[model samples]
Target: MSAPRVFVVENTLAKMAREPGGRNAEAAVKAAELRIDGVKDVSLASLIEKAEQLGVLAAEARASGESEAFGPVYDLSNAIYGVAGAFGLKGLAEAAFSLCDLTDHFRSGEEANWPAIDVHVDGIRLLATLGEKATAAGADSVLDGLRKVRARVMPAN
Candidate 1:
């Protein structure tokens, strides 16, 4: 297995951190980095170790209800989707995107939407698992998750 590419994720984090709402959002970015470390079929022990270093801080911020952190997470997560797409990991990418979007939706005024968001997050974790084992399948799994979210959020015509 090849190392997961960090190109998109890194840049995405930088961009997201610039937002006025990024103070809390930064935690999500770190959390997402922690997530990337766990990618399967890839020897990311080094990355995982790094994630461990930051995970505690990120977790604390999240637990503190620094809701602004949602922005960074969404940004980083979206970038992950793009990376997945570039590597033909559409399922994994889409699933990640779905979770990001769900988080955004919840932040943007859908306070009572965790049930749906939880479903999306679950799909994202599954896709991430796939990414650890099969990059391509993981990307596609992400795409599928995104589609599911879209189906629920998009207006029926």
Candidate 2:
């Protein structure tokens, strides 16, 4: 029996970084951050669209009082969280995460806390309206309110 020979390939990205004259890793990272920051406005557009869509869905769920109606809210909040976090919208990202946590509590328990969902929807909208300045005074207040709202229903853990 003959053993098959194994070939190892160096990662292209690693090789490029290690090669002489290659761009400085730190400089490349800073350059990428600048590029990402340029799209901050575009991220707000996305946040608006996502927030609008989530608002409608949450409103419907509140009206019907059906647990299943909020099913997609959790999934959509994940997308919201991703986009908000990627753009460094700290307040918005925190709000999205709180929504996700509240949604989990809503889904697990027998009765749904529709009002809490509404609170989160409103919070998200407020954060989005505050725009790219994640640390704005309004954003901080909204985030603080959301934390309290989510804390009400979330089981201590």
Candidate 3:
């Protein structure tokens, strides 16, 4: 298969560099570079493990009808978003972001679309297992699935 596209979001780095701190501009740039380097050093296996654990927690919370579970689920989705985006897992990142948005909407008194959240969780697991190469290879199909779920979960606004 062809090499996967590196999905670096330069804007994220820029935003990090622009964060308010007592440090000077050069120091901020250095900090941003270090953050990116740190992400490179992270093990993908560990990230996947964390995502799996979060997914299970989300499922259990949903099953138990715990409204408080929104916080954990939202945090899990954000974690997935960060890790996947850092690792260039664009499909997974998008899926996780959509899930995060859906959870936020639900928490804001919108109807919870549990089935759509399941689809996002499934996408996260699938992309985590497949990694970047397979994800790039199957980008079209993966994105199609995510888009369908997003449509279902998105509050009419």
Candidate 4:
């Protein structure tokens, strides 16, 4: 009920800067970006491969009655979600995140929403085919469609 004691913690990096051996955080970020860039091509290719695999898995899973296939889809999409932004694939990351959200929403059901699953996987693969700076016509429209489909499938409750 009294005035709280507020102990201010000094910015560690600013304190370090005042010292002799401090480094510019911006330079460190640039260096880190360069390192991550080294693996960008390989990572992008792997993501595409995973996206393709997701399509096949979704088809196979529905055929085999594996309602739990959303589990693997969630895992792969989550991984894609984690890294897609770092590589500047905004659409791909958005689709991946949508997929993850859809999977989570449908996971507890007795049957998975196959059409929604297919739409997301296809959307992801399509986005993966486009480059990071892709300004392809209707790209935003595609992203918008993804959001629409997610809404249609998993209506807000």
In model 4, pairs of residues that clash are: none
Q: Which is the leading candidate under TM-score?
A: 4
Q: Residue by residue across 74-123, what tens digits does model 3's lDDT show? A: 88788878877877778878877887887887777776778877777777
- Stretches of model 3 off by over 4 angstroms after superposition: 1-41
Question: Tens digit of lDDT per residue, candidate 4, span 1-157?
Answer: 8898878786998786689765688988999989999999998888888888888867766776755766887888998887788888887888899988888777767457777788888888887877565575546877888889888887888
Which order, best to worst by lDDT? 2, 4, 3, 1
Q: Which one wins by lDDT: 1 or 2?
A: 2
**Pairing residues by index, what is the TM-score of model 3?**
0.69
TM-scores for all candidates: the values are 0.46, 0.78, 0.69, 0.78
> Candidate 1, overall lDDT?
0.55
Determine which window of 10 residues in candidate 2 has minimal summed lDDT: 126-135
**Candidate 1 global TM-score:** 0.46
State the lDDT of candidate 1 residue by residue for 46-92, as single tens digits: 22332233234334435656567556656655655666554555565
What range of 10 consecutive residues in model 4 has the weakest lDDT sum? 130-139
RMSD of 2: 4.2
